[model samples]
Target chain A: MITKSIMIVGVGGQGTLLTSRILGGIMQEAGYDVKLSEVHGMAQRGGSVVTFVRYGEMVAEPIVEEGQADVLIAFERLEALRYAHFLKKDGVLIVNDWRIDPITVVTGAAEYPENIIDELGRKHKVYAIDAMKEALALGNSKTFNVIVLGAAAKHMDFAKEDWLKVIEKTVPSKTVEINQKAFLVGYES
Target chain B: MAEKKIMLGNEAIARGAYEAGVKVSAAYPGTPSTEISESIVKYDEVYAEWSPNEKVAMEVAIGASISGVRAMASMKHVGVNVASDPLYTASYTGVGRGLVLVAADDPGLYSSQNEQDTRCVARAAQVPVLEPSDSQEAKDFMKFAFEMSEKYDTPVIVRTTTRLSHSQGMVVLEERQEVPDKPYERNIGKFVMMPGMAKGRHVYVEKRMEAMSEDGGGFFVNRAEYRDTSIGFITSGIPYQYVREVFPEASVLKLGMVNPLPRKMIEEFASKVDKLYIFEELEPVIEEQVKSWGIEAAGKEIFTRQGEYSANMLRRILLSEEVTEAQAAQVPARPPILCPGCPHRSVFSVLKKLKIHAAGDIGCYTLGAVAPLSVIDTTICMGASISSLHGMEMAKGKEYVKNWVAVIGDSTFMHTGVNSLMNTVYNQGTGTVIIVDNSTTGMTGHQDHAATGKTLKGKTVPAISIYHFCKAIGIEHVVEVDAFDLPLLEKVIQEETERDEVSVIITKAPCVLLKGNHFPDVCVPVPEKCKKCGACLKPGCPALTKKEDGSIAIDATMCNGCGLCMQLCPFDAIAKEPK
Candidate 1:
């Protein structure tokens, strides 16, 4: 089997790293070698955070070079645009259709960019979803990361059973039913 | 059947470490990472304690690890910076038992002074780095890191980001391993990092890394994906999955152990793909390494070197040239700031109003540097404020320094401010040091400190007061004033500054979020007797605002009234009405 790289990006407190954990569980349960790394900058003051996960046989480095990401799962739209260079030519880009403006952009020190998809059109196959909205529909507005994860899982080779099992293993039993349902919605959507 | 629990990423790390039979855990409390030790505290087996600072915490962990019991040390990214001196040597000295140091990074200045990357430290130490994306991974990685530590006889770093540390997810519980009670036979040369001993340890570290690369192949931590391989991605942590999400058909390589990376596995994967993209966060450590290996790759450049990434970020870089204006318009921005009714606000408010050039210290009180309050002038380290104020006083005569008060939090004062306080008294510097005692370490979710009179385990400890502490330090004028009493506080501050010798004002107030406290003062609006002189605006209270008619109105809903603005107003227009 070949190795594949994935990148997850979002603002701090948006569960970016939890998405990494869920994926890590799925990959581990699927019996694949996995290495996950995350970088958090100024996370306390509501800054952005990113997580990098590599899986498959014989994965070497912890980071993916520009234009080589097999998949890019973003919790925020603008964040998706921010790290687009990591996507390969045919890379799959699944982004939550949400934008969390940075402090500079919000305070008008910098102009908020207009279109994320247009900028990403040159090198990736982008699919945007209102994952946060779907998560809110699942009863918790914060579960947007899970919803996005579910959508990303749909195109992955890891079996649905393995994913579900890993999800069960990763999450508590109390919220298992809902998270599973959320995952299904994300997958089947 | 065992029950699974939904836990935060930090809790999972704690549980993971516990399951791995971690015997000793130490950390200095900081956001995005504080909960690791706190969660470990709930377990019966682990000896967990919040050390005085990150440096002490690292030393304690090192001492524990040397005892042959699996030990763990954790801190935020900056905390790791403080502990770097020990961390660098610890890697060379190696570990007797498993040692896992967790560096929880804060990207985007979430709660940090700057966005310094921790990956560089991982490489600098030449230790294996494990990055976990989610809660379960955080837990599993914790166990894997410990196992790797033992196998390699070196400390392993489990690097977690803010999202991974604070966000909650489901985690299946498992039986924990029993920890060995006895210490390992000590070899002074191996444990000690003196020049001669360190050289031998370094050679051993290199040998371990070689064995790990050879014997560690096909391990569960490294995996490969074969798909449409026109381009393949190599990434770790949470970003690995995002790469897969964005490029479903591309082959990908995911590496869990980042440092001393599994080179054999990476080379095999690189041969299949026509082009490679390295996906990681902050700096291009991996990308630079790949290039050094003579493998041309791309990452961080097209993807931007700063901030976090998402599918949209990847798509924008690789798919589209730019984002539509409308798409950008749809994004929402929420930035964290000092929570409303923060106790430190009043102290900074008085300082800013009095035009005092204050040297600020760490803690939640550091938010005083932000706009609207803009009270703090300089923030160097945890307890630098007091010493800085002393220097400023000595540098720029006492008269100029009188208007400059050093502001520090209660937890900070307990940490290192006491020495500076004694120095001020010893040298007879007539500087006014204002202790914003919020009754807790407010920056890190109100953790208990010595001043809080509570230990980590909820037991009562001796409570020390800045008031009495200053008095004992030979400051004859030690005054404890209500920080919310703005008028009285201003007068007291002025009086303290004019004093010939060293003095202090303990602006004491419980944090608004503190339980079981009644601070009934609410902002009262006066529409008639008001002149819009903007005196109340000078304090920049969030509750007070100018109405459309140019009269200052108070949003009772938003105000605790604290009556701070009332004191600033000369017209007696704003008064606290009985709630």
Candidate 2:
């Protein structure tokens, strides 16, 4: 099988680690040889962070290089715009239409980009979800990443029940029900 | 089929250590290497600890090894520098049982201050280092490294880069192989590193190196993958994966043991391939040695010795193929900052208000050097802050350093900042040292330290008091102030700095992310009370932003109820609204 590459881009402390763990769990459940590369420590303190997940019959590189990602799941619009080039020509771009002004913007060193989702749509297929708004509507804002994952689930090979099983196992036992419901919200959307 | 589970490279190494029957493990928390001890501590059979510093950790492992048990010490690349004193000597003394160190290097400077390679240090110490490519090899090579350590009668290092340490891949689970502990023998000539004894052991070290080099090829860790003979790459660790990604069918001489060059394997691989290239991250340790042997291999010339190597790098350099991919959008860089209610922000804000530059040490406080607060002037490793401030005082006299205060986290202070403070006391240097006591270690993801009153295994222990530590070190004016209490923090800092004697201000606050830390209040903006004064935004907290109408607003989700802005607001425009 050809190696399927997925990139998760977000601001640190945006629950990217949990999202990647959930992603890794689903791929492992699918019995694919998966390699996930993550960054921890300094980068986790409100900085831009990215995790690379590649799975196939035999995966080689742990990192998904520029123009190699089959799916780019970004939690922030600015982050999506930043890592847009990493997406393959036909790759799906799933962004959680949210904005968290970076320190540079907070310090007025640089301007936050405008209409990032639309700008990305100009060149690539974009699936933008207001996961945060939807998650807040669901009464839990942290499960927004799972919703974004659900939105991207329509493109992946895994089944709904399989995704539910992994999500249940991946999240805390108390969070299992809410997370499953959140995933369905995205998956059905 | 074996039971295979996905594990992070660090976790796999821990599993390998468990399988190898390591009895004791010690380490200081550092990126890439922290999780190794973290993962291993879960095994009931193995005893693990968070040693205050890398040197202490290395020596702890060495002591365990001398006590006839298999032991290990893991630390990041810079930590290797701290552990080097013991590590260099251990290479000669070797192990009583099997001693292995996991030194994770950050080639890309992803989480480090510098991109220092561990292999370069291993080579200087004359130790054999194993480089594993994936989680499976990270586990397998760890077992192999311990065996090699006992076989060669020399300490061995398993060198992993950030990519190898952080990546998660499939690893086959294996049962623990219980290795018998060797009975301790009194060999004063070996254990005791007297100059005379060291002279004899030094000769043995050279012989051990020669033996390791000769037998290196036979060690299963080094192998040749014969595919297309047109191009051959001699690579190791994570770079090997990149090689496989770029040239799937190309011949590769993968060296798991990187320190001692397997000459025979290199010669055989070089003879078969028409062109040979050495692909290694950071320093040209392998390429220089291979080149010295009168073998021509292209490395570091076309390839950079900086940062991480990638498949696209090989495609661009080797094939000379230009990537026509879209350029990454020029966006505002999201540099890591102190979290919304980070106590460092409060301390740094006070320092900024007083226009006092801080000599910063490692940890989250280092971010204070960044814009807005910009209170820190210099940062040079852990514990350097206190000593460097003392140095400035010695150089420019006592009054010169009054403008500068040393700032270090509680964990970092316990690491080595305590010693620097002691030195200041001994040497009669006057400088105000701010022990930003965030209780637990910050930046490295909140690992507990000695002062935090907890062990790695979650055991309750008497936490060391930084205030008492400063007092015990003979500092006359040691005081503690609440970090969020800005006026008190500013007053204490100013009072301490103005004192002619060495003084310390322990700014007390637990990290906001620490378990049991409750912020029941959120900083809410009173837009009507706002006078468009940018007083609150001076610290540049990401949570506080100015609206288009020029009035400040605090994002409730982001506002950690730090109340620094509330304290900073002159017109009482911001209030700490209960969540």
lDDT of 2: 0.91
* TM-score against truth, every candidate: 0.74, 0.99
- Superposed model 2: Cα runs more than 4 Å off: none
Q: Pick the lDDT winner.
A: 2
Give per-residue CA lDDT, model 2, range B212-234, as digits (tens). 88888898999999999999999
Error of 1 at A71 (Å): 24
| Model 2 Cα shift for residue B421 (angstroms) | 0.9
Chain B, per-candidate TM-score: 0.91, 0.99
For candidate 1 chain B, which ten residues in a row score worst on lDDT?
B323-332
Once fitted onto the true fold, the runs of candidate 1 whose alpha carbons sit more than 4 angstroms away are A1-189, B1-4, B184-186, B321-325, B329-340, B390-400, B418-430, B467-477, B498-502, B571-579
Tens-place lDDT per residue, model 2, A1-189, is 999999999998888888889889989988899999999999999999999999999999999978888999999999999999999999999999888988888778888888888899999999999999899999988889999999998998989999999988888999999999999999988
- Against the native complex, each candidate's DockQ, computed on alpha carbons, is 0.10, 0.86
Error of 2 at B439 (Å): 0.4
* Cand. 1 TM to true fold: 0.74
Model 2: colliding residue pairs: none
Error of 1 at B118 (Å): 1.5
